[model samples]
Target: MKQGGDLLSLVGYQLQQANLRLETDARAVLADFDLTPAKLTALILIRDNPGCDQTTLGRALSINRSSAMKLVNILVEKRLIERQPGRDLRTNALVLLPEGQRQVDAMLAAVHRSDTRMTARLSREDIQTLHNLLTRLGPATGAAED
Candidate 1:
């Protein structure tokens, strides 16, 4: 088979390029919600883990404490999420406000639209196969556990 070069043949390079495009598209789609991918992730994580704190959120998203704080602050300022006293006096539990819940649904719908557009070129079977291969490489759900 003909190949452009070793650089073009590298799986990591290809994946990185794909990720950049997807992130750009996701950011555009998320714009109407006034959310970035990190912020959207923060909201989703908080929703899924209602009692989780800032430190947990940072670790889950592979971001530093300051970065986490920035995202948290924005969400709080927007009244989309709130911080309440946690089990530990020093920690604050993150919870979505009513507005956050409504925004979450809208954001999810927008993201689904982006996903549909992105995958329009792939058949259902092809997409399934790609998902299976990716899971074998590194399962998205299990990454945090590791």
Candidate 2:
């Protein structure tokens, strides 16, 4: 394939292109569960960190408080997650419901399959190197684990 000259050489452009492709595959995988990437990520995070409040989850996702609240509300409506009283009276602790757990477990496997298929062209070493390089390019500020 012919490279697009200077644009092809730009890291941001390359990352965007890669993200578009990965997101497309992810969307397809998530469709089976009727979820968006954000929702699935929220579910997984809630499952892993039971009793975590929306503020912490929002910070981890790099989203604002309002957006996080809206996401949480949607999940609550779907019966996928619940909000209980938090450590403070002002906050609500996020917890994944049984149905959410079941969905997340299946979704994890589907996402893994999708990722493996997408990276099939690369060897295991190549994938590892790519992951390491990407990690190095991540934010300098302490952000949530990828």
Candidate 3:
């Protein structure tokens, strides 16, 4: 197969291409649940971290305050999450509702299946090596694992 010259040799370009393909698969999986990647991620985070606030969730998701608020509001409207009084009066603690938990559980499995399908061409060792290399390329901050 013909490669795209020097661009094909660039790690960033390769990673972007891979990410786009993965995201496309993810979107297809998410579409069944009427969810987006961001929304599903937010629900998972809320489920994992009980009583987490919007600001904290936003930081973890690398989004700003306003965007976080909008996301939270949509979740609230969808009845997928609820905002309760936080430790501080200024912030609202986020929690996944039962429906949200159910959706997340189902979506998680679907996404995993999608990923498995995508990586079917790779051997176990190849997958592990790819994961390790990607991890190494991630930011040095421990938060990168999240």
Candidate 4:
């Protein structure tokens, strides 16, 4: 008996719509670098966690091992990352090459640009509050558990 047709009033619906819009904008922003958000995220993680192994990377990225391997393969092919023998002979540790580091710096700049554009309508205080709220929500909902 609830036929108000006010879908926008639902918080979950609004969140989903906003996420979709952000994804669209992000894809456009990252197109120039031939990267998706996941790829950029992986590169940044690999850069920050030097000598990290594929299993650790996949766990951090919330992806499966196969998917992680594929991502690493693409980055290696692009000459953005390299793999070296780990402490154990069976493990391969990932490292960002100099080119990868340079690209990651550019990627950070691009992310900042996107963030600025996305939050243009919000005041700095509002943005900070929103970030705080989202940080709380993610953990509470276990959406960020991975």
Candidate 5:
């Protein structure tokens, strides 16, 4: 029992350290693209879920509607994304432009490299174990099958 508690505490600390390192590394790569992590993430969301409305994006990103709108404004001004009127003509549907797609592809590649470097300390089996554990803890774990 004591050993299990010790292992849990140690794992918590390791996860915190890993999160901080990821934040630093992500910011460095995103800086090159003139984007913050939030912006890049919002772009990716737009790309993957075309026609998603602001409220939906806000929920997915865990950001408020205002923040989502602000990010959307930036992307629109940069010509990376555009908005279409939803069925009700009230909500705006997000769509990635060709430029947005290019940016997303580049960002994804950069993020992949960053992730590889961060996880390089782990063996392939260790990586798989970590992935499986995290998936179970994540929001979509059960929803994935639905």
Candidate 6:
């Protein structure tokens, strides 16, 4: 391929666009609730991985521990997440608040609409193939576990 070919044709470019769309749609979708993307992401992470602690959550989200803690702190301040002392007593395990769960459900609906619009031209298999290709280019879920 020629250097710096039109970005749209590049998978990286498409994924970047997809991510931007997700963020933009999500911010608007979440605006009334006054939630930021980072806060919403932490809520979703806790919802999907109920027993997750800061260290693990940070790694999963590809953020550092301090940043993750700051995000978690905001969620806690907003009462969107409940942080309980971990069994280790030195860490905090997170769970989504009821309101947070509702937010995630609503966000999922919005994100689904955005995804459908983004990939309207692709077949189900094409979507799966794209997922596989992206995974091949980066460390996937289990690979991120320390």
Scored by CA lDDT, what does every candidate get?
A: 0.89, 0.92, 0.92, 0.89, 0.86, 0.80
Clashing pairs in 3: none
- For each candidate, C-alpha RMSD in Å? 3.6, 3.4, 3.2, 4.1, 4.3, 4.3
Better of 5 and 6 by lDDT: 5
Q: Count the backbone clashes (under 3 Å) in each candidate.
A: 0, 0, 0, 0, 0, 0
- In the predicted model 5, the residue pairs found to clash are none
After superposing candidate 5, which stretches have Cα over 4 Å from the reference? 1-13, 140-146
Consecutive 10-residue window with the lowest summed lDDT within model 2 = 137-146
- List, residue by residue over 88-132, the lDDT tens digit for candidate 3: 889899999998888899999999999999999999999999999
Cα-based RMSD of candidate 5: 4.3
Q: What TM-score does candidate 1 reach?
A: 0.89
lDDT of 4 at 113: 89
**Candidate 5: tens digits of C-alpha lDDT, residues 1-146:** 24555666786766776789997898898788888788888888888999999889888899898988888899999899999997577898999999999988998899888888888899999999999997776777344663
For candidate 1, the lDDT comes to 0.89
lDDT computed for candidate 3 = 0.92
Local accuracy of candidate 2 as per-residue lDDT tens digits, 47-137? 9999999999999889999999999999999899999999988999999999989889999899999999999999999999999999888
Give the better candidate number (1 or 5) by TM-score: 1
Evaluate residue 50 in candidate 3 and report its C-alpha lDDT on the 0 to 100 scale: 93
Q: Tens digit of lDDT per residue, candidate 4, span 60-111?
A: 9999989999999999999999999998988999999999999889877987
lDDT of 5: 0.86
Off by over 4 Å in 1: 1-3, 139-146
